[model samples]
Structures are given as structure tokens and as C-alpha cells.
Target: MSLYETVREELLRRVRNGTYACDTLLPSVATLSEEFGVSPITVKRALRDLRAAGVLVTIRGKGAYVKKQVRILRQLDMRMHSLHGTDISLISVTREKISDPSMVSLAPPDQMMLCVRKVISSDGAPFLYDASYLSSNVEDEIVDEFGRNFIVDALRKREIRIVKTEIVVEAFPATGKAAEIFDVPNGFPMLRRNYKMVTTDANITIYGVVQAPFDRLACSIDFPTLAMEI
Candidate 1:
């Protein structure tokens, strides 16, 4: 393997084995270079690559640190008719909650109440708390089909397709149960996501809330901005 790859793999192994826990600062570039018997540039490159891959994060003027564990973000492309175009959908749900349940009132509720909560971990370290709620009126069987797999996969089996979604992201101080689930001190910042999924025919809505360590979640949007005439 390439030198950078070798270093990255070792780093990742350390992360997985708890040598470097979440949000833990890493050694200096020079220190790593000396220990790994490589030039500082090689270590820098490896660190850069890992940061870009979401395995590490560099805070300006603060140095590099381990990023919180993240799950594979299932891509929700707006242009795609369905996740796999087979009438199935896939959504991620975790077992974390916000400081306030009133935040859910931001949207109108629909029929049916299918909700699932799960705790997500990285290398066995708890990192994410997610809860997903779906309208219960669509079909009882459809709700029952939400098996142990991804929620979208279950929705697909019922012939319900997610044609569109709206996401709202905000940062807030952790409180009450939210703080405990995230394993953060009181007032520590956490990311709260309010997501809504819409189907093609049933006008159904699926809402979800995800609470996770601020360092663990990263979001990026790629859309062309309108250009103005000079």
C-alpha cells in the first residue's frame, strides 16, 4: 500500500480501537512524522485525505482531531425519482431527541404514526440518536413492513416512493435527555435535523429528528447559483 494509505489505515485502526476517541486531538504532524518514519509532508497528506473523508477534522489554529463517527449518508438526490427506482425508500433513524419536543410542531401532522428509534454507534462508541416518524394512515401493513433494515427499504416494499424531501438543520445547546444521549456536558452544542419526506400519490409525510455530536455530522449541498449579468 502507499505510504499515505498505510498511515491512514493505521490511524483508522487506532480510531476503531479507541486509541483516539471521538473529538480527541491527534498528535502533531511532526510527532506523527517522526513516529511513522516518514516526512512531515506525507503525514500531512494522509491527514488531509482522512479529514476530507470525514474521518478527521482540522480546527483552524487548533490542530487536527478525530471526527465523531458517521454512518454512510444515504444520498437523497432530488433528481432521482426514487432511491433505487423500485418503489422503495431508505431513511436513517437514530435514537436521539432535542431539548424540546415542541420543535416538531413546526410542521403539520398527517395520519398514522409509525416511528422508530435506534442508537447508532461507530466502532461501538455511541454517536447518534435518531427517531423517525411516518404518517400512519397510509397502510397498516406498510407500517408493519418497516423491518429491522433501513426505513426507506421498508417504504419501498409498500410501493410508496419518496419523490421529494425538505431538510432543516440547526445547532442548539444540548439539554435534558438530549445531552445525556449524546454524552456531552450540559450546554454542549449538538446538531438537530428536522426532515420531511413526501410520497408521490398518498401525500404522506415522514418526519425525523436526529441528534448527534456537532463534530460527527457534516452536510454539503451542491446546486448551481444563479448568475447575474454584469
Candidate 2:
């Protein structure tokens, strides 16, 4: 690889891993040239590459600074937009009996369960993929008109208010299934969130997870705080 490509890869790694904090100026071209043992021209070219990638911003007389984190959700909150969207891309649906030991007790014995796996897209590009489970197979619910949040929608219909929620968010390389669904190369980095919904009666009403390509979603402030977006 060329010297600038080598430097760019390392710098990209630093920015991604938070070694170079967001909104902070990167090392000067002179300093980077010395560290990478390359000419200043090469370092400038590498920084320019990052700028084109939306990872860096160059200001006159101020060098380059990591771009401030931006929210990609626009006006819609994730929970509402992901489910109540007019632009959903359905992938597949499966119906099965409740078998998970922990979740079996959430509903009556022998309750038929439904699983909906879908993708959320923008400008024709898929960005989020999710697999949601519901306590019953409301076949008609698949219609966009009836399709709201599979979990919360069902609960709300019964006036079951979620009293408490438990959410776990983390980053992991995309699984084979997710990589294909997201149209990303294998093992691409992704953000995942697993959550449990509890009703006012203190019952765990639903459990499911959502995954999104890390690049499409700008993590909220505090770098890792982006994990809370789910």
C-alpha cells in the first residue's frame, strides 16, 4: 500500500476506536509525517481522504478536527420510526410455538408466537435490521396500517403500559445473517440492542433485539454514549 494509505488506515483506526476523540484536532500534518515517516504531502492527502469520508473536517488556520457526532434519526425517535415507518422492507416471517424457557411463561401455555424480521431503509439504502417477537400470530397485523410496534402495540391495545424496561446495548461484528441482510461485507461492525418490556403488573411482556450498521447511525454524544441510541 502507498504511504498515505497506510497512514489513513491507522488514523481511521484511531478515530474509530476513540484514540482520537471526536471534535478534537488531529495531530498536525508535520507531526503525522514524522510519526509515519512520510512526507507532509502524503499526510495531507490522507487527512483529505478522511475528510471525504465524513470522518474529518479541515478548518483554515485550525488544522483538522474529528467531525462532531450527528444524529441520523432526524425528527423520528428510533422506537417509533423503526416500527411505524411508511418505508419498511419486510424480509421474512415465521410462526412457532413458545419454547424459550424464560419467555414461555410470558404468555399462556401453547400460545402461538410470531416473529417478524424486517429492515429499515433510507433513500433506498438499508440501515437497520430487526427481529421482533409477538405473543400471538395476528396475521392481519402485518398490514402497514395495523403494523405498529409488535411489542408495544400489542401491549398498548390491552392498555398494558410498560412500567419498566431493561435494555442492553453493545457493539459486535455483524453475524452472517445480519451482514447479508444489511448488505455489508462479512464481520462488519454493527450496533445491537436487546431489550425486555415489563407491564405495570410486573410481567415481562416481550423481548427482542435490533441491529444497525454502525456507520449509518451516528452514536449520540460521549462517544460510547452512542450505545444508548437503541
Residue 90 lDDT, candidate 1, scale 0-100: 32
Give the TM-scores of the predictions, in the order they appear.
0.52, 0.52
Superposed Cα deviation of residue 64, candidate 1 (Å)? 19
The 10 consecutive residues of candidate 2 with the worst lDDT sum are 74-83
lDDT of each: 0.67, 0.67
lDDT (10s digit) by residue, model 2, range 1-230? 98889999999999999999999988899999999999999999998778756577788798999976543543222455453333666677667665544343334346566666777776666767766665564446443422344556655666668776666667777668888786555556677766666677443355656788677764342343455535
Candidate 1 yields a Cα-based lDDT of 0.67
Worst 10 residues of 1 by lDDT: 80-89
Number of colliding residue pairs in each model: 14, 0
lDDT of 1 by residue, 184-228 (tens): 555666777777788865656677776776666555555569775
